[model samples]
Target chain A: MAEMYSTPHEILYYEADVTGKLSLPMIFNLVVLSSTKQSVDLGVGPKFTHENGVGWIILQEDMKINRRPVDGEQVILQTMAKEFNPFFAKRLYRILDQAGNVLVDVDAFYTMVDMEKRKVARIPQAMVDAYQADQVKRIPRLAEPTKFEEGMEADQVQEYAVRFSDIDSNQHVNNSKYPDWMQDVLGADFITSHEPTAVNIKYEQEVRLGEYVRSEVKIVGNTTLHQIWANGTLSAEAEITWTEL
Target chain B: MAEMYSTPHEILYYEADVTGKLSLPMIFNLVVLSSTKQSVDLGVGPKFTHENGVGWIILQEDMKINRRPVDGEQVILQTMAKEFNPFFAKRLYRILDQAGNVLVDVDAFYTMVDMEKRKVARIPQAMVDAYQADQVKRIPRLAEPTKFEEGMEADQVQEYAVRFSDIDSNQHVNNSKYPDWMQDVLGADFITSHEPTAVNIKYEQEVRLGEYVRSEVKIVGNTTLHQIWANGTLSAEAEITWTEL
Candidate 1:
């Protein structure tokens, strides 16, 4: 497929993670925004979402981080549908550096929902047709995380109750807000002065309304990592390396 | 000089105005984030900021908005130093769409400060050398605001006391937090359901600690459109169009 449509964006400081590269949650949010625009350009913009009072809700996500891209590095994010069923759709994505080197790849699953009922619904034919028609060329699917690696238990752990402001467009705790779990574990002093050099994270599950997730941080020599889990299932995990300023 | 580096960002829903395009404050925040990174990559980064016990502060800004870019549209933001004087450094920036169309151009002055004394100070030699030597090319001088915009008048406008969370990394109001000013002007119901479309705003001045500024918003034509103003002077004037649903 031709480029069809493309938008540009600049990375900001708040968007940067430990490695001083953009954080995974931020990357996820961007994927969502870009995909929404692509949908609109395909004439599906806000039809089912606004007119029918329905929207896509991310039920699950499996992502892997190969390498961290530094702050101020220009890159492109492209999205296209991989497959769709009556209830769910699988989408593929790639993050590339300015020279077109693949930085990260993601495969996401989404379900349609009735906003008022807050229940999953069948995918609208019109919506699927819109994305399928505008589907950009697909990139290879991202590496999915293996079962939890041994010795991965956190070295330090902290907990936080979700605040009202933490919710995102979907009215759920934003995927990116999970990083605050790590930041809280690192404590204010460490974060205020030190910059993370790189970070790799995966969102295996999500923390829902009014619930608190424990953010655990582990140290292995110079590298510090963190993760959040609810009940026994992993929610998100991240590795951060800090440098003295 | 050749471009040393640039970063790509995807627009988020929270960043969008009612028009579904990104808002001026959101774009401004993007520039601030990019400029900070430029300073860092130039080797000035946060080293000089810490050494001086002060940080970069945006003193005044004058910007022009030609067109608005919608949410999910990737728009490249480019930044460069225009001139470095004794106490202040002038920077110029441009926001471009995929075809490299300029959506907005900004010219503003930033000053180094003594955080302890709350006073402006000359640019340190080390800082100047760091930015000048970096490969990001400098731009030509910029145009001044065409009209005479006044600073806030002491009385007559509605007043708001700043909140603790309002202070951002630099200890000032997180630039984006000001849009809540418009929300303050409207009833709660309008904000919960209606979405904002297009907005035009200018940051004429800054509000500091212990200072309260007045807010004024005027409805134009329909309740959906508003002309918002702050303080006696036009701290910022915005046109917000809302979408029901």
Candidate 2:
């Protein structure tokens, strides 16, 4: 069996939204935490990468929610290094209720970049052996972000000046903030009245310090196509499916 | 001894700022999580209060950091209901390093409000007993938020439209976001180079939905005073002391 890690997590109220459900940003944080812990256990943690003059980066992620965990609810978070290529790797994560019913499923793609050259680095064989995950020669396909229709105009546009605190350990805007910047533009009326059912994100560029990004959203029914633009470039694109509360 | 609760928290990458230390907001979140767990263990969690038609609120908080915990560091979070009056209570929390040295100390003031009447409610004696904490006849005095020097005009101001997810379970802006909105206006240069040594905050008014708030900051040497204004009223005020990194 491939190596796996799991932990019990209690959804703190501070992590919940006005609807008393786990917010999308926090859901992303918690699932990432699970994978991080797994890496640490496998002995290829951040420190390990830093010592090797490399850094981890996320390229894309897809999330499907059967049900968002609620405040004060205890759930089990599980993650494993599922598949890998010489250039990229995929991690599979799931949140399970007490009854073992999966509440959320996520597939995240990651690659290591050399700190000095800033180029994608080959996956180390020893690191893959630590996790007991399969090494594949082919790159795994990630779900494409929701596509925008021709001549479709954004229903709403909001801009956010990046916060100093927005810079995470990566020394750049954290991946979790992307979803917050994307969906929050939907306005309070739609946000508080709807729940996200699924989300797909593709990270194209990193947000720089002191840069203000504009978030534009096109809504049609329950599916919303979103984009985050920084420095006049499309930094990220996403699609989210929601259900009315 | 009062009924004390403690938990181990590993500072994750998402929780750290660019400085590699725990961000002010995440520190607040972790300490609050410890206290929340204590309340749940005492059988008086959010559910109990909701069923009793009441809600918990923070009036003020003061935090002093002897040293900030770094990324990937494991620290012990301890909290206990220290003192209480008929209407207010004080919870003392400490974050300790593995060597048992205190890294941060915080004292938070809290009171419950009647959900329907929307007024401060008297503390129930039975509830106090559960914590095995002291009850005082007089309201406990708290450290006032740092007083501003007269004629001090804010050097910088940033406006933020309240996000839909910024509202927590209370249906109001989360107290943690107040610090983020405040310090982020210091810009990337100050935030990446200076580390906060202490923070004092007083929450006066709650922010409303769809309202754009302005964050104002005045810096004099190592101290910065901050304010959050919504609807042309001071919603929150804070003072932070920093040390050059």
Candidate 3:
């Protein structure tokens, strides 16, 4: 079993929506940040990776939410390096309440990229040794997010100019922001009236700096499928399952 | 001296910009949040204010930055209720490193708003007593941010759509976002090339939910003045003095 690392977090007010629960994007960010914390603990964090001319990039994630934490709530994020292949790695993250009640569960996949060439690089042996990542011949694949239903029209489309704040230290749009761009098309009323139960997001291409992205959502009943288009290219796609609040 | 409250915070990656320093808006948010923590410690947090039919709204702030904290750094937010008159209260905030070196200092002014009436209200006695605020006869006025020079045109204008996530619990755009709209006009290169040494910002009106905002900026030498207009009404104004990186 891989060793686990845990970090304490407080849900800041700005992270919560009108429903008082952590916004979807913030939820994603917290989980991803937990993994980063784990990487830091393993001595394979951004500094180490960047020094070696490579950096980790998240390509996909699937998350299940038991309940969303509200504003000013204290939560524990637990993460571990699960397994990896020659080309990819898989990590697990769990957000728990003070009493150890699970609030969210996620399985995230990552790959290392060469900073200079912007190409996927082989998983470094030093990282594997540091994380004790189980060396598997092939990493298992997560289920693809479901596509839009037949004849489904775009329920709503929202345009956003990627602000400088949207960029992260990785010089790319952070993974958490994709959900905001996607779900924001649902509007304020819908956001307040429903809670997300499950979310699956896949990144096809990186959204660069200062690029305007159009987020389109097609709602078929309680499940909304979202696509973020940047200049006619699909940047990211997501599917969210929601239940009435 | 007013009662002081101190809280510890870790700088998250998202809060850091390309320059590896905390974003200007985030610095403002942190200091303001420090005051909120003080309020909570005094048992007059959002819950208490909401139940009492009143809320604290920041009207203006002036900040001086010795240095901006970098990501992954642990810092302490120190705040205290300073002085107040019948309608306005002035507070002081400091962000310090682990070694007790000050990174940023701010003076913030606030007023109570009657949520039901959507109007400024008298400062409640209970809060004043709880915080042990000195009842001063008047709050000293802050220096106004300088207006544009003669015949100066807007250096750049950027339009933004108010997203669902932009609205805070107060049902209006959060104060932190105003600096973002103001400074993003400087573009990514300028942001990375310079650091803000001083900032003075004031609010004239609130930007309601879903309202489009136009941010205009005029740069004179190293100082940039900004105005945020929502449908031809000035919502906020600011001036930032920048130093070369």
Candidate 4:
């Protein structure tokens, strides 16, 4: 079995943000893309795409950031399976700096879906075999959700529209982008102190081309919960927490 | 005259970077898009796009960042004609925070090209007339080409392929991405400290879809000068100076 699956990524200019720091949303994006590449290398290649008309639907994700990284830092993104079931697969990610410092840790849960039907499908057998063969070390799932209640007041709302650029390879709003929606309502000040420690989302609907969604947030105790509604329907609900760095 | 064309842009999730801060590339992108929108607002509206059968080509850019803004900060992007010649047009931009703080100041030069002839074309009279009528606080051309020195030592050459994602609506590497390539050879550390005080680049070639361009860079004194070459021909070149913040 392979010991670990790792990919080296060069921080592109588009990726380096104005603060000269890598933005969190872009970090999540790179992680998702690198993870997809890892899956392909494991021989579960885009088998579902252009052939079986299948793709992975992100049910939820919880990520924690230790520190912000700067632009042009060559980063090594390492991802591995934490656990798998008939319907859901959980994966964990570690982002390492050049000197092997862990910059961020991410845990996400995804379910396979039939694109044509847009419904959750059983995990393909080939994928299960590939995960078993993947050499990456299996890590434990994150213990709990992120916290955002200390300074953030509850019952705030922010609205966003899906643009042409938001669609990814599968033509749906990329899963990594949802975290951005969460950050939008929280404002920049909140993002400064708290990084996403855990993100748990339930995807009940899909957002397509030219649609708009409203993020309604409520901070309950230590938990900052969000509900994303599209055209008055609950598309997804998320509960996240932020930790002081 | 349409009082100093100001464009309202909705921040997209894809544009949120790793730091959860908006990326420089995306800001640069919005500048270009807003500039064009200003032209469309003035009724110039890309007639040259159909006439010359070639679109605008960014020859050089100089962007100064005073502060970095984060996601969901709705700001106004104001653009105006600073100067133009028969061969090229220069534009200036101001990115304001919601509270009216100047986040960034940018100046750029672009030339129309005749695609079939593969050469720069004369600026259309209609385009020039439209922009000249709507000038706002026109500052003297921000670029001082005389400050740029040529013929320096060379050290390393790095190459990058233009991916599908790299292309913008204009169908070239989004003009903003060129700065990333410029920074790639400079190393992330040097680039972060050395805010671009001034820049001068000349685009001589177009990087087609899926073409790889090699970047050759040399650091001399306080300036790092670099060039992008494609198929053994020079595509663009820039000279940047480190500024004290």
Candidate number with greatest lDDT: 3
Off by over 4 Å in 2: A149-151, B149-151
lDDT of 1: 0.59
Q: Fraction of true contacts kept, per model? A: 0.08, 0.85, 0.65, 0.00
Q: Provide the lowest-lDDT 10-residue window in model 1 chain A.
A: A133-142
TM-score of model 1 vs. true structure:
0.54
lDDT of 3: 0.87
Could you give the candidate ranking by DockQ, starting with the highest?
Answer: 3, 2, 1, 4
Clashing pairs in 2: none
**Model 2, B87-186: lDDT tens per residue?**
8998899999999999999999999899889899987777789988888777667878776544578899999888776787777888888998988888
Candidate lDDT (C-alpha), each: 0.59, 0.86, 0.87, 0.64
Per-residue lDDT over B118-166 for candidate 3, one digit per residue giving the tens place of the 0 to 100 score? 8999988888888888999988988888875434689898999998778
- Residue A69 of model 3, lDDT score: 92
Model 4 in CAPRI terms: which quality?
A: incorrect
Regions more than 4 Å wrong, model 4: A16-18, A133-154, A192-202, A220-223, A243-245, B1-245
Off by over 4 Å in 1: A1-14, A17-19, A132-165, A180-245, B1-14, B17-27, B31-55, B59-85, B89-109, B113-121, B124-245
Q: What does the interface RMSD come to for each candidate?
A: 6.9, 1.5, 1.2, 15.1
TM-score of chain A of 2: 0.96
Off by over 4 Å in 3: A149-152, B149-152
* TM-scores, all models, native as reference: 0.54, 0.94, 0.97, 0.49
Model 1 complex DockQ against the native: 0.09
